[model samples]
Target chain A: MKSFGVNLLIAVIWLLLSAEPSVIAFAMGFLLGFVLLAVFQRVLGSRDYMRRVFALGRFLLVFAWEFLAANANVVWVVLFRSKESLHPNFITYDVTGLKPFEVLLLSYCISLTPGSTTVQVTDDFRTLVLHTLDADNPSAVRARLDRVLKRSILSFTR
Target chain B: MTMTEMLTGMLVLSGSLLILASAIGVLRLPDVLCRSHAVAKALTLGIFLMLLGLWVYQGEKQTALKILLAIFFQVVTIPVGSHLIGLLALQKDIPRWRHRPIDDYREPGNRS
Candidate 1:
């Protein structure tokens, strides 16, 4: 019930933010949400409100912190680096999180960071290839990612 | 000089410099994946700054919105394009530089 509320709120907010919105668009978006909710209910065997709230709280906290950290990292990179000799590399790291949405969030967060981007998601979503400007310390970032993902999973899945 | 003119001039100069820097980065980066990063971030920022300047000078809300939409589209698409290129590079086994010691992903058996 709460997830449905959250989803409905998201739909309304999206409608409000979009350019030149109309009743028809709102109806279309609502219909789409209904269909999605129906599908979600079928796949997950009903929504668990407690679990969803716990998961959402964890995601919000971690995501906010990661965003701030990424922004700070960007400031540091922009200030110290002189735009030369930046050896960029794409490296693959094995991922160990369940849930497709969590994986998607991780990838999007990586892409949002200034010097790093997510390149590919494996077929099973078990691994991701990431392109980073400072590939020297890729493991550190990967470790941080793992920690964040673990926290997310503990909050929601377990 | 007029305030608008000054702003425009600054915007154009900064935008061009950003573009040049991105191009240089792309050319100088060690690997295909790195180069893609340069193109995705620096190039997009350059273009966005440039468009923002043009929009500011125009001072029309609709035009500004359009420019913003353009930027939005670019931001949304650049990552996808960069990701695709990276996947292709990985498929080809392009080597990435590892100056640090703690890359667990770069273990002995993981040299692909």
Candidate 2:
């Protein structure tokens, strides 16, 4: 978080220095700041910053893919699939050791993805109740959620 | 007339179509949870795509930045909104569809 603040500060400084004051200028500044931080990692204690940034980028790409796939799946179910075949169900997800913010992100990802909407989190924050629009196989759905959303979230956060 | 204009038009059209699909899902789906799925995912993505089309059409850095910001907020907030709504419905004990829904949250004996 400190490194992120420093990076943003550098970007803003660069924006002020540049005459155009455009988004591209700010982005270029950010990129330059990233490189500088990387080069002087020992001084800045930003050893994790570079890896976190890469993980964040990968997570974003995975999220984009999930978002598109979700849209496509919903479109197919809505437009083409018959109503009788639909099987909506609630499934409990174990979130034993995840932090609150991580749980929040995971819930948001699950809610935004195909076939699932997170309905509630238990008081202990160890379990999440998800309402899946179609759960032909409950275990399969759970496994997929763990494999796709949970894994990406852990990679970025931890 | 121009290629950019055509691309923008196509993107906007598809985005609207996806939104339309979401509307259909809300009407055709069996229950509130399913409807929320349509609204949260499809509607959100549709709006994002539409904003993207606008950004592409405008082709201005400032406009693009603003649109990106708008997309960020939309993406972050929409799911939360839907989650709250779903949570409310669950708390209220809203009736679900007739389909067999496996609720693992409930005790094995309590499931209906």
Q: Name the best candidate (by lDDT).
A: 2
Best candidate, DockQ-wise? Answer: 2
Candidate 1 backbone collisions, by pair: none
Model 1 segments beyond 4 Å from truth?
A1-102, A143-158, B1-4, B95-112
lDDT of 2 at B30: 82
**Tens-place lDDT digits, model 2, residues A38-138:** 99999999989888888889898998899899999999989887778887878888888999999988998898788898999877677889988766678
DockQ of 2: 0.67
Measured with C-alpha atoms, the lDDT of residue A88 in candidate 2 is 80
For model 2 the local lDDT of residue B111 reads 35
TM-score of 1: 0.57
What's the CA error at residue A27 for candidate 2, in Å?
0.9
